[model samples]
Target: MSPYDDVEQTGMGTHGAKESGMDERATLLDFPGADELMAAGQVGEPSAQALSGALARVGTAAAAEAAGRGTGDVAATPVRRLSARRRVLVGMFTAAAVAAGAVTYANAGAGSAAPTGTGTRGETRAAGAGVFLNDMSTVAASQSATTGKYWKTHTKAGDTYLSQSMDFYVMNDGKAYKKGRRPDWQFGPKNVDWKGLDQLTTDPAKLLQLLRTPAKTNDIAPFDQATALLGDTPASPKLRAGVFKAMAGLKGVRLVGAVKDSTGRGGTALEFQEARSLGRVTVDPKTSAILEYTFTWTSGPSKGKVTHDTILSMGFTDRIG
Candidate 1:
């Protein structure tokens, strides 16, 4: 049997405790619902475009490994677990593999394992995640204020088409456009204006309270509203800090430490689970910027499918370009 088969089957090495040829230090744990995820779908053939995007997302190490070999030739590469700072790196690589057609990730169930330098199970730690967000509030509050003619945000959203991902841009002045699609204000949440955004209260509690008002938030969940505001607007430092603080107060926001965003930038991930799906938001610990937001449908018609909205760049820009 191939090494990949071994990983998919027993998930153990010769000694029955460690992963073969990967990290010997971390113990191999059976993830919950491994059988189900595996049965859901098998990894299909990797497309050239998907492989190129994956390699580019992984950066130097994976690139160096694939330097001589063509992208398709690296199919034999062994998957690794998350370890210390490498957690995000491995996550991105594994995600790329998934996007490249590896549907069954062996490490998905390692939610109970603590993140060391060896590997991660992508589990959430409640207390740890809360503390991290509170700290981020402080970090965000210290950033210098910025302003420009328009608040611009560039995003790469879910693959609803053959291209595998959709790229779009939204401007605060009610203009939205994407490649191969006509420009419209319908790309983002409706009724959000720069003037309204500027007048938002900087107080965390009041801001959250206001968001909870169904009329102002368009009846969207306050958490979703807050994250949407954070991602699409160039809110002031205090307002940005307020968003973090408000999120910290929300229950079930767990920390999946040191995971990479869709763009492959390492950041801390905060997740909240609803009845039908799980939503995760990754933020840069240093800058407290929202890097990516992913939603995975767990128990619906869309079960096992994942969609990610990644903020490629966001700030006050002189022109909407």
Candidate 2:
């Protein structure tokens, strides 16, 4: 089940109540830290992993090469191409999880205790991707973490359901995650309590190991979800810092400086170049909560095509609606 596996991978619960457009990119094989994480006992046998880290690097080049070294295959949404990043995961971790249906993320509750964070940024602070993520993580860790019974998000995206290319949408759900489900009006809940995330150490190295360890059906979506879960859900500030650090290591990704979201809120952003695609995450300058997740086409026929989800509002709730 390589990230190259011909399995029909669709966006998770993406059939929205509107209109849009889309396409799919294959997963890249990864070999980035398999041996290192394995030696440190973060994952299983190093040999068992298809997407270590080296393969991720190679997969990107390979995808670009397959497309004649163009940028990305930015056309249809149903077909999945490979990238260096998704290669290793789909080739190894994601493939296995897709087959065995054994990949599950931690959803338990986290303690109410809050961790002190570090650093502060102005409305338009500028830094490299690595530094920006690290600084934001410090701020996140410092916020007092409170647990809630429910998880909700007010995200606005460009009709991701085959380019449903629409407007603001909200997701409200319980903590339960059902695999292979369509988008919901009031979806089941996901935890922000950070209870299940305790095993994820604060060390960037160890935290990255956990982020990559999850077996997912889709190569790229998991990456977005991994980081997006921080602002969309509840977690300790230290845990958020770890996630930021982990994602900062992604290839071709960098800080894009201060920007505004659809809501016209000021925030800092980090982005990565994926083939013909670019993905960016923006965060509130003061609170450090994620403000938006944006993906746009930089090349191909769909160039300038963009879709993003803005976290208008989210937090722990007492009950589901």
Specify the highest-lDDT model's number: 1
Most TM-score-accurate candidate: 1
In model 2, how many backbone clashes occur? Answer: 63
Q: Model 1: how far is 92 from its true place, Å?
A: 32
Candidate 1's residue-wise lDDT over 1-321, tens digit each? 211222322344457544443542232223222222223333445678877877776666444443644555333544443222243344345435533443321112212222222222332212244445555565576567987765556666421111111233443345544445222211114344455555666777776566555553243555666777677565688878777767666666666656877668877676777777888888776567889988888897899899888987777655544
| lDDT value, candidate 2, whole model | 0.47
> How big is the positional error of residue 142 in model 2, measured in Å on the Cα after superposition?
0.5
Segments of candidate 2 deviating more than 4 angstroms: 1-126, 156-196, 210-218, 221-225, 299-304
lDDT of 2 by residue, 1-321 (tens): 333443333444557412212223312222332222222212222333533443564455446554662434433433334344344343333223212212111111111111112223211112355544544554464456776654555456311111111122332342333233223111012222234455446677765665455443334533465555576545566777667666655545555556788889877676666677877878774456888888899999999999877777776655434
Q: How far off is residue 151 in model 1, in Å?
A: 1.8
**Candidate 2 worst ten-residue window by lDDT:** 104-113
Each candidate: RMSD to true structure? 16.3, 23.0
